[model samples]
Target: MSFLVMDDGEYSFIWETLCDLQLIFHPKYSREGKIDHKELLGLNIKKVSVMLDRNLLSSLLKLTRDGYLKDEQEMRIIALLMTWMIMNNYPASAGLALKEYATKINDLIEPKRELREFNNIFDYYPSMMWLRLAEGAIDSIPVCPLPTEPFITEIKYNEDDDHLLMHIAEMLHVVYLCRRRELSPVEKMLDFLIWNYKYLLICESTLVYTAMLFTSQSGIKAPKNSGSNDIGKILVGCRNQAWDLNYLSNWSSFHYYEKTMDEIFMFATNDILLKRIFINTYTSGGVGALIEAVFSKSDSQKIFEVVNFNQRNRIKPDFGADPKIYLHQLIEQEKHRVMETISDRGNFNYH
Candidate 1:
């Protein structure tokens, strides 16, 4: 049996579909769009650190300092810290540099332990009820015989890549929700967040600790024109960091750092898919409500079954005969479905 390599156009279509869904859901975001001010800022890195067990921070930092991370691993962990710093009072430049260093050190040495596999999702689990609900969503999607092409084929998707796979499934669900035309804006966001709550919380916690170290080493200041009077300086700094998408370095290592930072910041700030929900929650209700929602649980027996079936049966298919044609067809189907979703409303008013 032969395989078909996915082309640029295929990848572009998948990416664009994701982007279009995001914009359709969240129309207020732009590369230069402003973040609204909020009284309750993000988690306090230092305060959270002092309150938590010291061993947790020491163990992780030790592993990082020992150079145990893999490609994109450090970025994922450091992004949390960068967001923490931005939420606190860390200077945007300083946060950027810390993120860079975190990404650079993994190349220097091997680890005594394979830390990636050892990281437990349960350790970061939210409230018991919340866990059940998220697990339920996980169980809801129909598990097909693993298809070839477009999705994972020969290569087995593992825990590290589960987020990616789960996200694809989640996107399909979002499409399903849209087609039904029954979900409200906030409810849709809640569903998505709850389904991926573990990863989101881990990112948030990891970021808080990461930022704490940076703040301790090099104190951060607010950007110019961003003041107490401005009412949105912290958020503005985050937006500014997201906007500065260009690289400052010519070397490969540093360039990788810059590129990763740009991607993470852009996702954190402008990609309204998740961030907007978070921001809206924080601004209106407060962090406590946000935490509750992130950790809240509901029944998952149905979703769990769907997830279980897919995990066992789905087969990745080869679009080898006509990869581009298959992708175009996929795009058209989604377009038609989206139109059906908005038919009663008459039109999609995208700004």
Candidate 2:
């Protein structure tokens, strides 16, 4: 029945540190070698376990009592804390006590929801909130740490993120893996874009963008031996599923959606591969009409102003091409390349 109060900054550090420690101690969660504790970590693990078990049940009860089942963030925090406790090896007694409460949270987060006809991607927020917590549960796994890499270092402390990209990426991995029949093909692509949006800001290599695009489209883990034929199909498959501007316009109204679109603009401005994806999604995916609308909408103009500047100066010099012409050219080249790859695959098999 004890309520603990801490400032956001302190709570964030504690949360991150616990997440890191969980991975550190649980080698099954992370590939990194476990660290031997030099001394007892300051926090009493036993006491915290008890608190999690107690508070989780109490929180759910309070939430229900207040008739605020729609307060997803609160639920998400409770779920994450419970997940963190489980990762840290909460006692059997605590788990048994909290089992019913945990089940309630799980039922609330279960991926299946009433799919509305007027589907905006942001409306999936409750599902996403649950999915992210689910990801935190799963992402307590092993990945090699990247150090001395400017990409990692540069983004680790970006004001926009609180050193949570690694965690976020892991969560996205969970989303990427499970988006199958749970989502439509278009929704899967949207999930992919959202997952890798951060990389569009930092990664300079077109290869990274290309790989991510294909992987997202395929809904399969990227294979090292994937040939040109395999890639061509993925590209074609993704492009064929054009976007709906209605969805994008609806998406734009959400708070963080702009950041994702901004990343798309940055990606398109920086690399031809991503530009093809962006332009295809824009023209075919229904964002083109929205962009036109955005231009006249003063409040929304900032979204594209920086992107337009870069497209005009940087992309134009590289291709000396107008956006419309450039988009068409890229589509044609991709078709030619896909055909060539298919032809090559056929000839190679015959030979």
The sequence of per-residue lDDT tens digits that candidate 2 reaches over residues 1-351 is: 122333555445435744443322211122121222222233343222122223334443443234333555455554444333333333212222132232334432111211111112112123223234433432221221222211111111112121122222322232233323456433443444343342222121221232234335333233222233454443323322211111121222332343343221001011123223333333422333433332345423543454445445442223234444443444444345434544654742211
lDDT by candidate, in order shown: 0.29, 0.31
* Candidate whose lDDT is highest: 2
What lDDT tens digits, residue by residue, belong to model 1 across residues 212-243? 21222233222222222222332233223222
Prediction-by-prediction clash tally: 27, 7
- TM-score between model 2 and native: 0.24
Q: What lDDT is reached at residue 172 by model 2?
A: 28
RMSD of each: 24.5, 20.9
Worst 10 residues of 1 by lDDT: 46-55
Q: Positional deviation of 173 in candidate 2, in angstroms? A: 24
